[model samples]
Target: MKEKYPNLHRMALDYLSVPATSTAVERVFSQGRQLLHFTRNRLSGNSVRAFLCLGSWMRHDVVSPEDLIAIIRQKRKRPSE
Candidate 1:
């Protein structure tokens, strides 16, 4: 990576402040597992995806309602190309 993009390598090193490992992400998945075990219902792939995404977001800091609305608006404007 340094050889390919020295500037990018330096920038990444400076910008990335979070942990490199996926340990936090794995904990989120563990929460999903516990939820499934308690519910005991066969969840479809899409439902699982939604639950995981929601759970991750919920566990983190709350986004302002206005920020969420703006995000939805921006997402809607993008062409499906």
Candidate 2:
């Protein structure tokens, strides 16, 4: 069928590549909403962006807590008086 209908076949493949549900996107949005709640509204935009990126990475197991701690330790700054 693809040989006879190449365009239709490509369209079908593209459609299939899309997610069947929005659950993953919705979860990300929900997490962002929780992070930006009233009590935390004072967070700077860059801080929020960092938090969200870190959360996503943690959720996906791209970075472990130990790894993150090590990275922080490596970048820690000495107090300047």
Candidate 3:
């Protein structure tokens, strides 16, 4: 198979090196789907990645929920002007 499909093998090696299709990946995808509603469909890839990473961190207790609350409050404290 390798000899007959050398190019396909290389392509698979290159593109199939991503993370496993685990439950965690499915959970993130589910959350991202919810975020892609008409209002938020414009979210950039980076924003979606950040949102997912943050949620993952909180879910795993890498960052405390209270810290997220404080961060949100800090963001809200900024003056629009």
Candidate 4:
């Protein structure tokens, strides 16, 4: 296929590589949208990423609420240099 029609083959590869459904991605985006809407633009990019990751982790039982609180406290106590 590549040898016969390089351009079409490249185009097909590009188009076919995309996912059939963006449900998971859209779900995450929706979550982020809700989060940002609540926070009202107070969060930075890094903070948003951290919050999203933490939310996903908590949802999956990878981190508990207590653990998250402890981690936040520990970070706050660390002196910035």
Candidate 5:
């Protein structure tokens, strides 16, 4: 029916693309909470976001330690900073 009702078909596809479970989201929150506890509670929002993204990627094996090191090195500030 996609040809007959393209908008409806697109909407259905979009709806189906969303996750059916909250497990992944809950896991991220759990990890973030642990990371932000106690001494780390002062972390800024941007720092928290970066840590979450990097932690999630590392946990999922999406990027290796060497890759992370390379990324850090590439972004290192010059002496002028």
Candidate 6:
């Protein structure tokens, strides 16, 4: 098979030897699905791209849900007299 498909064999060998798994790819795709669930039938190309970028960053720990929720709560709170 390698002799018949040299490029594919090389690609397979390279992938097998890489340190990174398909986990990141799966995670990003999962996030994209989640983002699309609520926005299905209404998302533009740019909107989808933005969501994917944001989702990828979130997966990479650039943002925390707790902090986001706290900020939202603070903004929604009325000022004390």
Q: How does each model score on TM-score?
A: 0.42, 0.56, 0.58, 0.61, 0.58, 0.40
For every model shown, the clashing-pair count is 0, 0, 0, 0, 0, 0
Model 5, position 14: C-alpha lDDT score: 42
Cα deviation at 34, candidate 5, in Å, is: 1.5
The 0-to-1 C-alpha lDDT of every candidate, in the order given, reads: 0.65, 0.73, 0.72, 0.75, 0.72, 0.67
The residue ranges of model 3 lying beyond 4 angstroms of the native Cα positions read 1-18, 21-24
Per-residue lDDT tens digits for candidate 1, residues 5-51, read 76455545433546568996688578778878866678987888666
How much does candidate 5 score in TM-score? 0.58
Candidate 3 global TM-score: 0.58
Candidate 6, 1-81: lDDT as tens digits: 988976556555534554477996687678778878874958998988766754544555555678767877998896876
Q: In model 5, which regions exceed 4 Å deviation?
A: 1-18, 73-77
Location of the lowest summed lDDT over 10 successive residues in candidate 2: 7-16
Task: List clashing residue pairs in candidate 4.
Answer: none
Name the 10 consecutive residues with the lowest summed lDDT in model 6: 10-19
For residue 63, model 2's alpha carbon misses the true position, in angstroms, by 0.9
- What's every prediction's RMSD, in angstroms? 8.6, 10.9, 11.9, 11.9, 8.8, 13.9
- Model 1 alpha-carbon drift over 4 Å, by segment: 1-19, 61-81
lDDT of 4 by residue, 1-81 (tens): 789976456555543555568996798799999899965798899998778776866665656899879988999999997
After superposition, candidate 2 runs with Cα above 4 Å error: 1-23, 74-77
Backbone clashes in model 1, listed as residue pairs: none
* Cα-lDDT of candidate 3: 0.72
